[model samples]
Target: MNKELLEKGFIPDEICKVLPEGFQDIEEIASSLHKILANNQITNAVNEITQEKDLSKLTNSELERAMLLYSYVGHAYMWGKEEVEDTIPENIAVTWYEISEKLDRPPILSYASYALNNWALLDESKPLSLDNIRILQNFLSGVDEDWFIMIHVAIEYEAKNVLGSLKKYYLDEDFENKNLEDALTSIKKINEIMNRMPEKCDPYIYYNRVRPYIFGWKNNPATPKGVIYKGVEKYKDEPQLFRGETGAQSSIVPALDALLGITHSNDPLREYLDEMRIYMPSEHRGLLAGLDKFLEEGPKNKVVEHETFVNEIIGEVHKFRNKHLEYAKDYIFDQALKKQSNSNIVGTGGTPFMKYLDKHLKETVPKDD
Candidate 1:
């Protein structure tokens, strides 16, 4: 163990204590963190630390707990959502963006993004949901790269179940009439999941530890101003800047758009969807491109059925979006009660994008239909 790193607070002490000796390497630390998470030792630690309201005043143990939660949640979201032969990818030691650029893949692509993006095109059954957005907005105290990563985890987890239900319904010819009902049922299940997420972390703590990493292009008084692509050298002088609803993490929205047959105008959202693919794994991005080609060149009758099914799915998606908007409002209001600014809540700005796509889908019908 690196005693200097632990003493300097570069690495959380709690994690250092739990880590196996000679795991002095940072990558080894990251790997061991996931092992503890997989075994469920970190669950209690996460719960205990999140209970603290003042992150600024957090003891060393509490800080360790938070770091472990952030690291493990991200690790699980990245590797654990699906059944992989190995929990950590062989390339786990590489810097995230470097792995993506060198391998031409999304650095942190998870099961949720993969499943939602490909489920419509691939004839595979997997379990998915969208309620994690609500939990993220309402429960999490801060937003950062790790926070963004976990949002995908939540999305993938919920989306897995939702996709599982949809796959089963579509595979069963007898359940033809119940398709819409099943989609609605999936949305309701997502709502139930959102209702059950434990509201732990103190917002103040989140602001102190996590918020600094999520700044927009506007300069701010923070150590890590916006996300820095460490291994990418082209931007050595200037790091990339991202605000709400931008970046690879937001891929779920466009994936859903593709699945639901919602086309976007040449607007910012459209540009965002196009640009965000750079952040996806190469194979995942290829699958998305394949889905587009499939939609364009597939058989007419099959396309019609897909469009009809997607229209129904979009209707449910609209309802889900509205539900999230409602939650955002309530969550922001709750923050107001604590005298905390509501500006930091996640998913607050998603309503406009959702509304735009929903309207677009409602106005357009399959020409074959």
Candidate 2:
């Protein structure tokens, strides 16, 4: 529960692309994933990887790469083609599930894989920004897909600007008002970064190409009963439901919500946000837990600046949520429906996000009760 994020926010300090010789085959598949998908060679290519590779003696870093590679390949196998596949092959399923169990998250693509651990700096000496950063993986490569992930990376970079202050705010017994104020400023800046999404990634392209590969089995018509993992004993070959990679799984907003005492209305969306906590890295989830306890008697005083700080924080939250709602409408809700896979009604996270996001936006008032 200690403040582990000093500079990187939720992003790992490095992507650690270098793996042991055992993982070389998996790494090879990940390198040309788009080509494999284009030629419909995913099934055999991925299964062959687990055959020789003994996952028993790998490092945590190696497992992370396993998650990343398997997730990209799994999504591509399911959604890369015209029709969705219902069953995950045995080797792919077992390898993905084993690594997922080691990581304590579901066996599907989440935000951590999509953006948090998916980027690398072009110039190591330079700061982490869109200009210096590039993604390590892709679904079906395109500007729309690359831009979509990098934009999230940019926002994550900006969010870290507040982490030092937030860490101080969390650890200090006094709940320093200065720390809170500094974080409010960075939160406002994070919203500005989010505004740049449409500058390159066209909403049309994002809704179609970029989003399809990220959708999970839950609440999805393509795999209506969820997905079956062929050889994973934990599932007994039953279909398992897991939400897809979504911003809801990101820790930035949730940490702010816990800190600033912002509360969403009691609804399914609230439940969904709570459910997303499990998808996040364990440390982030612990940070939120610490903040909730830290605030019990903390933020302890109500000085003149306290009201102003709280109001400004609330204002930024409003702006962030409203802007997200606007983007949701443009990027997903209002876009023309082309395929059953990319439904305008349901989000990639496998929820009726259009309805819930609008409600969640309206419910974000200047003050919480």
Q: What local distance difference test score does each model get? A: 0.38, 0.78
Model 1 alpha-carbon drift over 4 Å, by segment? 1-23, 27-97, 103-154, 161-184, 195-252, 295-312, 327-369
lDDT of 1 by residue, 1-369 (tens): 111211121111122223232222332333355354446443333322222123344444433333333333333432233232212222221233432344443333322122222212111243223322221111123333333334334544455444444433433345443554565565555555444322432344443433322223212222134334333455462444433223234434454455445555665445545655654444446646754664456343433555665555666666555554444344334544476654433322122344444444453443434
Minimal lDDT window, size 10, model 1: 3-12
Tens-place lDDT digits, model 2, residues 177-294? 7887887888887887788888889989898778878989888778889999888897998899988899899888777665665667677788888889888877778876776685
TM-scores of all predicted structures = 0.47, 0.91
At residue 347, candidate 2 shows an lDDT of 73
